[model samples]
Target: MHFSLFLGPGVRGPHEDRPAIDLMIEQAVAADAAGFTAVYVGEQHFNNYEPYADGLTMAAFLAGRLPNAYLGTSVVPLVLHHPLFLVERANLLDQLTGGRFILGMSGGRPREGKTWHKHDLTPEQRSRLFDQKLDVMLRAWAHRAGDQPLEFTTDDEYGVMEGRMMPASYRRPHPLFAIGTNTPAKIAEAGRKGQKVHLGPFDPAGAGRIAALYRDSMVEGGHPAELIEDNLRWLIHTKIILVGETDDEAWDVAERLFTGPMVMAPWIRRDPGQDGWSLRKIYRADPGPFAPAMGVPESQGAFLHRTAIVGSPETVAAELAGYRDAGLPHVHARFIFGTLDDPEVFRRSFRLFTDEVMPRLGVETIPGPAGDQVQIF
Candidate 1:
């Protein structure tokens, strides 16, 4: 399966003596050398879960640094930005990356709205807004003089004036548009549009439902049966850390590193009433039973395994094999999670995965621009 790396600058740690930007660059450099296919950055604001307020900027920096790797946003909160401005930023990044940019759009989370004290929109409203913004962006990218006109007016001395975005996107028809959400309708929409879907750690049954929904929607949308096979790219995001000699050793290291101070500080912690519920509760409350006991009993491990690709290279490989069998082609490994402070350990795990697991799976290691390979200690 194709491997992608997900970078969370804020979640990596607080902005201390070493700026997060530098660490981000270092991670990109390492990931590129490790021969990963793509690197995705998430858009998080006000909170420390991810420090990068603007994913487009970080993506541009990565694009410049790692020429061989594809750069993408895990999901941009489209509802937060004006469609025209967002489209412009996307086009610029697309050009900067030389057509290696993938646009991942989402309706955003309810907590994010609360952060800005913005009105909490209903799911339907958010979806509608998402659709409108997407439409505007698509049109702007495909803009020509006679095609259509997008008009915007501001309160001033003068009346309204017509306007249209200039300098369309470099990619013909537009850069890749992938929908990032767990909603069935969104997944179906991606299938109908022949775009990719981002799947995270969910129960195997849930995964099957997502896949089936996408496939069914593809057919219902009048897409050819094989369209799903041709263009359907499943981007699975999972917490993964490669272990060394024994699974036990890996578990010990993971628990210590993940639960450390730098990694799970106030920023990463969930605040009541502010950070909504669901995932925040999971993070706020115990990381769950399996998480506390690093050993991870089979039943609990099975549950976690559904969402995270952890353990030794062999173990991770076996799990990945199942995903491959289930029609997932792309896997986005989130190397940073919880509160892991030691970069060296992270590097080691990543290196081991590259050296051991990927090769056995018949996945070729394509170096990023720097052509650096990871060496396990």
Candidate 2:
């Protein structure tokens, strides 16, 4: 199994003045030096949750710094940009990264309202537009594979290509494609099309079923055996990870690291008008007077137990072994997130995991540590 680093947005308190981008750079550089397989970044806008506003831009910048590891977007919102522009940028990254780029995409952030979109597109409209855009992008790339370039039209955009797409991708056809989805239909369709699916932090027990659905559907859809094997080899899942000298120490630190600022930032700022409002409201219920009024501590505890892998090196290895045994081929470790202020703590835990735990996984990793090799500008 491959272990990669995922850089998500974090909360910076009022007194914390360091740029979030710097932290992202630090994490990516460290991952590269540590011999990680890949580094993925998240895209966020308007909200201060994510470190960067654009995933591709961050990936491009980090690609230069991370020569040893593959770079990809955890997911770029496909519906927000022109398909043609996205194709150009993705192809550029493919060339620049020496074909070590994966374009992970998603439908736009429907929860953020339409403020960032050019028009007020409903969720259904956005989903349809996403499909149309993907179709156009793939068709354009198909020209490189000897397919005739034909005229294409989306809801508000149309274009015709007379020849091969400009600055052809480094990889034939295009860079590897991935999408983050929980819907079985979407997962199966991605399998049919030979793209990867990111099963984000879902329950491990269900992951086997999802993985089976993907591979079984791929076989049923008549995709080649090599394609199915490669997809299975790179099938992605996410887990929040923290390691310590002992399991108890890890959980204690997790309660401190993920409890107050970590959980509250997103919960308080989330779109109340969107789905799961009532469920979130219960977690944010009134603690009454004379109590620490905030998101429920027990809720975060339960969340850590289910979603995060907080334990000693031995424990972490065992938990991850279960994932590998369950047929997950990739694990994206989220070492940084909201309100985790101490970079040194992150570094220590990351080093411990790399030095002690990864060896037991029996997966290939770059040798040696890259301490202080991180560059900043």
Candidate 3:
């Protein structure tokens, strides 16, 4: 099983501010040393909230620093990028990482279009655009100099032309492809193409259902049953906060991190009775008291117990085992979320997991300490 870490560039806010790119470099070094198999950086733009605007760029930087660790994007919003350019960037990063790169693509959120003054595309449009972009990217990666032309159409006009993408990916036929979505149709589409699917929001029950759905769809779509067993990789991303000695301590840390100014800078407005609101709505809401308070200590404690891998290493390992039993092939830990900015806290939790949890699961550590600098393999 692969153990991955999901790191955001940085959240917005003066008090919750992170150091600089240098800090990210340090964090990558730490992750590599702590024995993480891979690292995924999420992409965000416009808002000072998320420092990393280009996941490909960050992946390249980390690849240079940690040659042994796989680098990937949690999900790039393909609708916001020109397909050809996105492909080029992906290809270059894959080459730089010596094939240890996975590309995850997503349709941009409707609110993002409004932020950029672009027309808000419908779900069908986004789906079609995602399909087309994938086709172009795959074609660019697969074609050879004398092979078939890379062709695509935009606005009903077709164009055909291309040499192979420069800095061709080290992986044959390009690096792995992953689609991130909560919908069954999207998950089925990915399975039909033999692509990996990332499951989310820390819901194990939902993840199990989605994984089963993908496998079932793969068989229904004429893929061999063995194909599902061989090619499918299940990645679950979850929020986590580990406490050293007491549950209260863990709750305290979670509240501070989640409520930190940087994380909540663009506060999310929650309905009085609803659990939470989406980030898009949060960004659009006025900064009034109506903006929901961060999860209380007790509520947070319940959340951690329910959705996160927290507590001592033994406890965390047990929780992880439950996920494995549920059929997760990879688990992506969101160690840094909201305000959890203390380097010491991050390193300690990472160390505990690597030293105790990972070995118990019989997975090999990627090799290194928590913050050692790396070079691309």
Candidate 4:
């Protein structure tokens, strides 16, 4: 089982004094020192959803510090940028990182906090655009095989290479590419193309449903056996995590630091028109059964239950073992969220996880592809 730390803080409001970038560097360095497999950052913009607006650049910045760990963008919205630019940047990072970059991409959501002139695209249009842009990127990366410079033209997008795409990616064709989405059809398509996937938070049973779909489609699509095996091995699932001496103690810390701020930030700030409801609106209308006691809606508790692994080391390790047993091997854990007033709380939980939970899962330090391990400092 591979564990990746999510380095970006999911902040929702202005916090110029938070020193988020400094803390992020600390987390990356800590993860590398503790032997985490990889570290990832999500691309969120305009709103203070995430401290870093560009995940790829952030990954590049961390690359020098993470000698023992790979770097990845959890989900870079593909529709927002031209394929040529995206591919060039991805290739540069792949070359500089000694082939340790994973480009996880998405079609983007309709309700992005950042406003683009092309915001009016419907879901279908966005899907098609994502597919088209991905094709262009793949072709550009593979153009080295041909003698002629690559030339291509798409709707309102065109590129005529002056010479071969410079600095070929360290990984042939491209660095490891993974699609980020929970939609079954998209997941199946990604599988058919022999690509890995980053799924939303789900239990073993829920994850198995899509996991099976991806595997079956990979086979049904007639991809080679090795590619199928590789795809399955790299399946990623995201989760929120916190560890303490006991479940009750962890829950106390969660309630004190995580729940309320989460409710206010990312959840409440979501577009009210999104699915015709927002968490803030629903909470105002009715705080369900345990809301009064929990100080947030029962819905938020349920969300946490479905998406997080909060407990003592033993309990957390058991749940993760279940995920590995059920074929969800790569866990991308978000250890810090909302406006955390205490960085030590994050450091303590991270220490507990790496020292206790990670050992139970059999995580061991492995050499990077280049066979060099450099300390961050």
- For all the candidates, what are their Cα RMSDs to the real structure? 8.6, 8.3, 7.6, 6.7
Clashing pairs in 1: 10-51, 201-307, 263-339
Q: Which residue segments of model 3 deviate by more than 4 Å?
A: 14-20, 115-119, 155-158, 222-227, 241-243, 261-307, 364-377
For this target, which candidate reaches the highest lDDT against the unseen true structure?
4
Clash number for each model: 3, 2, 6, 0
Q: RMSD of model 1, in Å?
A: 8.6
Q: Which prediction has the highest TM-score against the true structure?
A: 4
Decreasing lDDT order of the candidates: 4, 2, 1, 3
Candidate 1 residues 68-182, lDDT tens each?
A: 7778888888777777777778777777776667788887867788765445678787788777777666666656656545543311111221354544565665666677877
Residue range 133-157, candidate 2, lDDT tens digits: 9999888777653566578899868
lDDT tens per residue, model 3, 123-201: 7877887777777777776677777777787532357866666766666666666787767788887777777776554
Candidate 2 vs 3: which has more lDDT: 2
Q: Please report, as a residue range, the 10-residue window in candidate 1 with the lowest summed lDDT.
A: 368-377
Of candidate 4, the 10-residue stretch with the lowest lDDT total is 287-296
**Which ten contiguous residues of candidate 2 have the minimum total lDDT?**
368-377
Give the alpha-carbon lDDT of every model.
0.63, 0.71, 0.63, 0.74
User: In model 3, what are the clashing residue pairs, if there are any?
Assistant: 30-370, 30-371, 33-368, 33-369, 65-374, 257-339
